[model samples]
Target: MAEKNLLEAFLKAEELEIQGKEFYLDASEKAHIPSVKDLFKQLAEAEEFHRIKIREIYQTFQAKKNIPAYVTKISQKQISPVFDPKEIEKVASVVTDLAALEEALRLEEKSIQYYQSLSDKSKDLKVKRFLLALIQEEWGHYLSIFDTMEFLRDPSSWYTFKEHWGLEGV
Candidate 1:
């Protein structure tokens, strides 16, 4: 049934939220730099909020018709390793703080793409709205990271208007 399919997709989103929370919390434990550690913590908190939102959506769907909610795809393949610690290792080799920030922005941008696709796949309006909000939050987080890193690299460049905004800024 179409409803079943919708429930499955909604459940998939819930699972993703849980996975993200776990990853962020674990990374927070391992991060040495205070800023890095705080970033992880902030991400984890966001995930937690997403998880709650997903559950609320799940409950809403169930309440609509008393239909049981179930997800068929518990897939790692759908999950992008966008937040992998390996990103930092590789970025560190090529550059320092500014480059590091750029790399994270890239990752977050990629995640926004994934979330957008996933959001499009959902039939429920509430679910779609939640996904859109998540995407926006990711954009904000990525911008914050980029701006902070820019500030760190050049204190004089605080709020310095660039010749052009990158994709993230736009």
Candidate 2:
């Protein structure tokens, strides 16, 4: 029964990843800024990678009738900031970009919740670990979107705060 539940969860996760990838691709196509477009493209790739991993795990579990040992190390590619300070002024007019970022945030939050819920219910250590890794990745995506949103809202302030820059003489 537990195995069945795990298999069902894997299927659901794969569907979620596919949805995320499609959304990111659409967002990338609609993005006005090159940096934002690149970010969305990277996110789409990450979602595709997740889908592939989930499919592989599902096949392995189905064949072995046991959860395979998951590696503790989850590799994530570093994503650069979504805007350059010089081009930040141009982003002020990008309301659609902001809207897309908001939607991305919602999607990532949903994925994190779904993975966390499944991880909480899982009895198998390997299954739990795998879900936890996914949760971490989704959380990273959420944070990246959030930071980009903040940058879009006020690039100068975001940079000042993020960089911990203080006025030494004023």
Q: Highest TM-score, which number? A: 2
For candidate 1, the lDDT comes to 0.59
Residue 82 C-alpha lDDT in model 1: 24
TM-score of each candidate structure, all chains considered together: 0.58, 0.92
In candidate 2, what are the lDDT values of residues 1-170, reduced to their tens digit?
38788789899999999999999999999998787888899999999999998898889888876655675645568656556767786877889999999999999999999989998998878878888988888888888888888888888889899889997878
Q: Score each candidate by Cα lDDT.
A: 0.59, 0.86
Residue runs of model 2 more than 4 Å from their true location after superposition: 65-68
lDDT of model 2, residue 76: 61
Give all candidate RMSDs, comma-separated: 10.0, 1.7
Whole-structure CA lDDT of model 2: 0.86
lDDT of 1 by residue, 1-170 (tens): 26677667668766766766676677667654455556757766776776676677677777775323343221212221123333433333333444444655665676678779877886655556666877877766677666556545543444335433345745
Off by over 4 Å in 1: 65-111, 148-170
Clashes of each: 0, 0
